[model samples]
Target: MSEAADQHANAHTFIGAIDQGTTSSRFLIFNSLGEVVVTHQLEFKQIYPQSGWHEHDPNDLVNSVTTCIDGAIEAFERQGHSAKDIKAVGITNQRETTLVWDVRTGEPLYNAIVWTDMRSAELVRNLKKRLGASEINQLCGLPLSTYPSGAKLLWLLENVPKVKEAYEQGNLAFGTVDTWLVYKLNGGARANVFVTDPSNASRTLFMNISSLTYDEQLLDFLRIDRKKIHLPEIVQSSHATAYGSLAVSKLRGTPITGCLGDQSAALVGQKGFTPGLAKNTYGTGCFLLYNCGPKPVISKHGLLTTVAFDFGPGKRMYALEGSIAVAGSSVKFLVDNLGFIKSSSAISALAETVEDNGGVCFVTAFSGLFAPYWVDDARGTIFGITAYTQRGHIARATLEATCFQTKAILDAMEKDSGHKLTELRVDGGMCNSDLTMQIQSDLIGIPVNRPAMRETTALGAAIAAGLAVGVWDSFDDVKNVNTEGSTIFKPLVHEKESAVQFARWEKAVQMSKGWLA
Candidate 1:
């Protein structure tokens, strides 16, 4: 046998991670050292049925995931590793992308309502006026907003006839992307493995952050008939058999284990296990999560409290999260919508054409501002535009929008947690740009740490799965998994300059408010 094959045979078995994200589905195979061995990603269609509405066809989500799994497994086998070498699979997905399906037939009653969808704006507004609405954040760690899965579910229940009929008949199965993917990945109606980790459940606003279970008062407030709709059973983030094995893939029958919402998984992947450690993920949207240790710390700022992860009894942790509604998607807008660049990769180069923003500031609140400023009525706005403002300045400002939000979130985290962050670990597509990372570092006045392996989100799922199945015994065993080839960007701009720039951003945000209202 080849030396490499012999080494693979003797080494610990691989772990597979199914990352079901907003824009794509990816299957990645990771080794014990947290190195990605093989990966396959497929971008599925994003459906926009109306203004401010976003969706995904249920089949597209399932089919794309299965295809990626099969493809990644094929690549792994080509490298002389058998599918049997993959001992377990973990799932990390876009949180709060809500879906409803028939329990009997496993057919979707309506398209999956994306977390970014604003169709529930009016519903959330009215819900905020209801009695006891003010107490929801204290109870569930989330305010009444269109971002939660519960809000989206309510919208479907009130608007979609099929969804309403399924709910009334007690045939409705409601879940976020994680639960739906797990149900479908385990053969849908056949095996019927319906469960969700605390991380995902926390985003639904139905689960109590402290108890980590469905709250009756929350149900009453949302007006959801618990008897009429079936919710996924809450489970540990990492468990040996809670998540069923893959039923239809080359790696069929592999035990499925760890699961976390995408942001939480990124935190795990970055090894943000200690309190005050934080990570920012710049995906379709930007999310900054600060680990607040074991107990939940309710945010005095506009941030939301969420489960960081629930590995088991004594390992549960919570996070203070700041969510930004737009990030890398704004770059896509420049490429696809405005034709400022040929593709997203060209954004940095275009922005580099200008030394600075040149007095331009982009709010990029396409869906509305979230976290620290929950301005639901705000719209995307640009300030200080002039003939001197070229595409580069706009591009620079576009990237700055996310950085500015991260700084704002960090400030909020400091106030809420009473601990200042010294550094930030970053991942996702946007973090690849040097200019972007430097901008982020300068804006936050902290070192921006980027791991050589940017696939921390997938690695996080692999870590969870590995932990459950004994591939790794504990967090300490995987602490040094992806520590090599790290790069840290230190702040270059003076703190005063950064503060002045941030002040301008705050002014723009204030001026941009209530545009929709």
Candidate 2:
């Protein structure tokens, strides 16, 4: 909608982005210019009990949506825009986190299995022995790992009595986070869109990459029966359906036009449409996505060939992704867990207090190293912590951990796509730190570009929704509207020093591996 038309008639409107992620839920209101008029966010609770178990209250996820939406809506009107002017909603969520709820009552059968949860590791290990990781990885474009939803679902069906009972009685409905959030946001118990997109489905280890549908053999392998569980209907990422009307807020008839896994949305938000384009999001964890165009190039170097996005049923794009389990959270760990720093911002100042890492390397594998270094048994380790080391060196090492892991993923991206990364577009909480961005550029030897809008996750969703509803024309138009400002950080570290740092990182990685044992 044009600004002039929007003023004359609140007839045409703004786009709403419902970004439900691993740690928080956010609502962002954006205009045709991709400028965020109003936004509200709430961090949800994360439960960790047993070593590898992670869970979330379904009600918490649901309530956060209502709360954040109301907050954002009020702020929108304060900014002279009507909440009623919102024409459509877009959903981008953490992918492969599975939830099972009753089809009739909408009550959750069990705590939602978080994507970071690894209690299913043993189950996946057994599955690997049975199916072989290579064959499963080839078929699904995903490794036979606990990170995928299929194994987690299988684990739930086997261990959780309520979930098993519901599944057996055919009253269970299964969905990833996006499906669950959309279902609840639209209409809790009655919502029947039981479906998943190809992008999210590809991470499940149950969907075939080429067919973009659940494979019968894979379902058989996971022991899931069609009669037992109501699976959501697969849909395109950019469809104008999936969700409509939320019960709590007395909201109805708002068409949800776009959906994507959070990482893919970041890729799109960064304008990574062409092949060789790549973007890395530094959130709770870091995710690097490299656009590989149409064909799926299965990763040979312990990476994943995930669906970049299903533009629609007629159009599909694919990418190779390398995921790191801990990035910004490492800084949180230093502040909250280790008590080394007072706050997140203190990290850069503390790091700069030291000339370098001072022979320390902190591998922030609180869970495990993901992507090319999938050491499932690995846990957090602080290497080279000699008596000479100070808090500043530790902070520098912690920050360097994120940069080193990112570089590894970038190398894997090069190997998979056969194109070296010339530049990287970055967005997220940590990307705001110039010290970190400089290190990122130095390590990758590429200019690290940052857009003016760090809320690109939400903006990406809004853009997709606007395009679907004909509020925007083409990529060129969205480009003009969305990517308004950009800044670039060029590499500053010497090439030889960078190489030495990388080599020391490799040594530390070797030392850190298998620490969980």
Candidate 3:
């Protein structure tokens, strides 16, 4: 190739983002301008063995990811870009989902436990009673809840026969979905890249957020022996040599240079690089992450302290995270389960048919309440229902449920961070709804900033990979790349009205408590 042709090829070089979310896996290819060239996604099975028990077949997760990567690359090549032009792949995964595999065979011992799985509720309660919540929280920046990986892993070790045997024989390897994907992508046992970044590791309840490494005492408190159960090595979120090479797909041999938990990746993708800048991702669930700078701030309120991202050795950032168990999933429930709408996108129009919730308040604790409440016993509840209630009211209430939960989390975050958040940067599937974004803004009493690029989660992974591979020289180069145009939703409701609505939401939440007890 001539010099000009080589330079043109280099200019067309892309970065790949592997977004392994709760319900689906997506691969997105981005150019230097932060524009997505092509993408592919695949939804997989969500196995519910029992009430509040959620499991994902480990193979399904791996297959969905690999397929998306191949499909996306095919599209990229059809656009006249070389597959080799893709520099590096970054991973952003649903956090706290636990998986165990064999050291020799590279096979999962049991179905991957999803983050929303509450089968670990009893285990969590027991640990809270035995060790108390403060000691663990002080060390690991997490409360004893079903949301953490430690509780899910404990449930597996005690209940699953094969997993227990693996542990006893010292052949078990434990990892969150991110680590599992990395391991499988790098040819598993052949060239196992068994590693996790600080963002994913912090959700395990074994990592000290300040030190950004696994805490031995915290592991001991959870009865997890580091020697018996193999844990992935803690690595930087964006490192030159950490995540390892992709040994499969059209982009085989591409280095995987960046990793972040899904919500943390969204935060980074939103360019929430400054402290106190908060972003809420409205995905299968809603996650509000507030950048808390370098030091970890233990939440006095019921928020989680987690690693936001660690770009390199000393570039680690901590965050206050609020997890809502149901958000877009509530919309999916209305469409798929209740037939309230034809599709998830039609929810906004269905909801718009009703001027308000018509006195109804929905507490969508599908699994349980997370962040600031920590109520594992709370089930989904709809209150203030009367004979005059209509489907539109129910639909409005369903969407409002997410907005109310966002408000609750914002209140808790303010209490924990000692400052009111001026605005919230938002992305994901549900952010496409103007009504929902307006409701979020009105309820939170702040502006909701939605980027022109809705795929910030994938963009976040791409940014990390691009940074590691020198696609962009520094943060400044990419800071304003895709941020030129944005839609901002300002609060339209009066403070008193929002407060009254929030009070009703709180009452519904309180009523929803102990339903599963």
Candidate 4:
């Protein structure tokens, strides 16, 4: 339109967020008011090389992100906005997906070991037998689990020849997916913006929880040479320069100022800034993150301690996190494998055909149980099925599996935090299911709150970038965002019925354990 109109649009620029999740990659453009103006998404491959081993092609992850960004920016331009109107970029990625590459060549030594991979279980078990294994939680806020990157890193160093060679030659560079994306987006070795935020770093079991820096003790415990393997410099979650500028995008040279783990980003997007505020994200996996305040609390229960986010220097917050390995993936299984539903959304309609699970309980342990149980031996199991069972009953049981696991995690979080959550802020693909949300609320006995703009994962990254570039004066400036159109699902089932359902689910879980053993 007019030159003045263009100038005004450029002055009030939008922020971009690259949300690299477990099953898909997305790019979103958000206005200063925390509303998404344009977006694009691309689902990538979920490689299962062998049983219990999950991997991703590093190039596929990078290409998916760049493609999504270009697609989103094209949509933004179609809406009459200039590419230059985008000010800064933020990134939120699936945490603990480990990667190692060459520093000079910028080529990955191995496929990224996904967070769900259980191949490192043996390594973790052996490590636990060593002295001072219990003290690792005090150092890194996490116990020995295959879910963290450290075990995967160790596996790469020991099994992969290229990685081991690079490690010995001091050419190895280690980072989670966020660090890898930032380095690649900034022109790989040319810009070398190799840095990670506290939220992602905390999942590596390397960062000291209190100081927010790498601990030498942890490095030694894992037998990693600090000088040989290059670790990404830890930076603020919302920083101006550490993330560097985008070198390959429609908005090339745009500064990437914000970074967080996917779950932590959802917490930020949901405005869970205050202590005791908690949010559960239902993506390929389900993650329940409880804001525990400034200090970290090592869970005496099964939950892990992690960084919620570090907005700026001295603004770090910690969280008690309970992770479920299967959530939306269960619906995908129903659609793709069983052919019970045509699309992911159809699961709700299919479940509606049945009033209840009809005495069936599906423990969706496709990748095994996580959180308090830590049953890596467990496999997917459906209990109490009979000749009378229908597809609708199976669909209802699949949804109930997610709800039951969420209730168990929330119970653990309540015990660890000494405060019960009044409500759960939710977002992601599965939260669209009214049946699932209602079941979640009833199983947990708390209101399940959903926002009008449910793409909070991308919104969180946008908020981080926007904050870093001064788009919003403070978190307060965007406090009222997504607040108007919200829905709350309260418990409808009686407490006794809920208890009976959970007990049956627990029995199924117990029956599924030790399958791999």
lDDT of each: 0.93, 0.83, 0.90, 0.90
lDDT of residue 33 for candidate 1: 82
In candidate 3, stretches whose alpha carbon ends up further than 4 angstroms from where it belongs are 1-11
- Given candidate 1, what's the lDDT at residue 450? 97
- RMSD (Cα, Å) for all candidates, in order, is 2.0, 2.2, 2.3, 2.6
Which candidate achieves the best TM-score against the true structure? 1
Q: Which stretches of candidate 2 lie over 4 Å from their true place?
A: 1-12
* Arranged by lDDT, best first: 1, 4, 3, 2
**Model 2 lDDT-worst window of ten:** 243-252
Evaluate residue 337 in candidate 2 and report its C-alpha lDDT on the 0 to 100 scale.
84
Model 2, 393-505: lDDT tens per residue?
99988888999999998888888778898899999988988888999899989899999888877877877777788777666766665565688999998989899999988
Pitting candidate 1 against candidate 2, the one with the higher TM-score is 1
Error of 4 at 513 (Å): 0.9
Clashing residue pairs in candidate 2, if any? 194-232, 194-233, 195-232, 195-233
TM accuracy, model 2:
0.95
* TM-score head-to-head 2 vs 3, winner: 3
- Tens digits of lDDT, candidate 3, 301-375: 899999998887556789999989999999999988998889999999988988899998889998989988999
lDDT of 4 by residue, 1-517 (tens): 8978854654467899999988889998988767788889999998998988999999999999999999998888898988898889999999999999999989999999999999988888899999989899889988888889999999998899999999999999999999999999999998788899999999998999988899999988888889898999998999888899989978798999999999999999998887999999998999999999999999988899999999865567899999999999999999998888799888899899988888888999988799878887899998888999999999999988888999999999999888999999999888999999999999999899999889898888988888888887687877886787899999998999899888888888889998875
